[model samples]
Target: MTQTPDETASDAGSQLLDAALMHVPFDGWSDTAFRAAIEDTGIAPAVARGLFPRGAIDLAAAFHRRGDDAMVTALQQHDLSTMRFRDQVTLAVRLRLEAVEDKEAVRRGATLFALPMHAAEGARLVWGTADRIWTALGDTSRDINWYTKRATLSGVYSSTVLYWLGDDSLEHQATWAFLDRRIGDVMQIEKTKAQLRKAPGLSSVLKRADSLLSRVKAPKSKHSNLPGGWTVPR
Candidate 1:
């Protein structure tokens, strides 16, 4: 069976990521870890280099993407349709968080992204994770509302991850409490937005933003429906 380009990349990423993970705690997410991973793969150095030209950053992004992909699969076991939207969101986040057993590795990744020069990369990573979680939860939004929802969720997930990193309580009880508070904040914001939408003269601005997205980006894939389950006008 011939693998498509995406399949092949996914395969390489998985292999390299598994190998690199063993070295992360000691070597950090630097070339040292990639070299160790490459050596473990027994692949030519050039091939491993090609797989991740930017080295650790590429690997880090791939690592998160791998987790995000797995999160989608893990969510399948739960009947999200039976839950309310808030419950679905909570479960989806928990499922994603549960996928990582290497708490130290997550800590390292967080440190890596926190570098001053990597600010944009860190933002992208947060946005990507939030986008994946929302998509995995059946978000079908479009337009500016799409961006706003993901932006809101990025705040939630990123803050939760930060909180989780330092959490040592049994079962991460503190982190979950933090998550619930953040989710509550989101619900409150939604309620406020609902009231704002009721005020006159804002409809035209939102409609234009939605129209702009369709013109500039259109639909790209199953996970490409912008992001977030904003209640857009049909």
Candidate 2:
């Protein structure tokens, strides 16, 4: 039986995700490899390739071009040399000691990072896009789950790149190791949550109270005071 467009897109997305993780740099941001990856799932290679580098600035623009799928394609088209990866990675890490400051490249890198594992390849291409945004902003550290998210995704991207560099395994043992660490962290979090759920009501309440107190003592919002003393516009 023939597959629906959605099915074809999903399969294509999975392949792209795998390819991204493998760090197989394409000849161009919108390279033939990316197109082939998606086309292999039955989508036309030309259609798949057209989804990338659309240059849309907003979600609406992205949606008009098929949303996340289009964005991922654009990401694949990202120009690392123009972004100055060689300079930024070195300067930020060496001189400024602030590697996270290169938010743009980091964001682009993140997008590439999540491409392979996107839930529906073309469906939520935004996942990869958002991953890049977060990484670029260096705000991943600001959230409690940032470490988990960044480490896992980074592992996937980095490990895959490592594999592509010289992987002999079916899917690359190094990549598997990276994924294993990420999965382990998630499992640990789940186990902790489960244990907390089984705790006595009073204990749970105390934990909740403590959490609330911590928030209360945390730093104030950066945008606490805006024009007219309103934090949010009406």
Mind giving the per-residue lDDT tens digits that candidate 1 earns over 1-234?
Answer: 999998887787789889999999998888899989988987777777788889888898788777787888999888866788887887778777888868888888888889998768888877888888887777776555567778898888988988988999999999888888889899998888777666679767766764655543324554765632334435
User: For residues 192-220, what per-residue lDDT tens digits would candidate 2 score against the true structure?
Assistant: 97787678876778577546443322113
Pairs clashing within candidate 1:
none
Write down the lDDT that model 2 would get. Answer: 0.40
TM-score of each: 0.82, 0.28
RMSD of each: 4.9, 16.7
- For candidate 1, the 10 contiguous residues with the lowest summed lDDT are 225-234
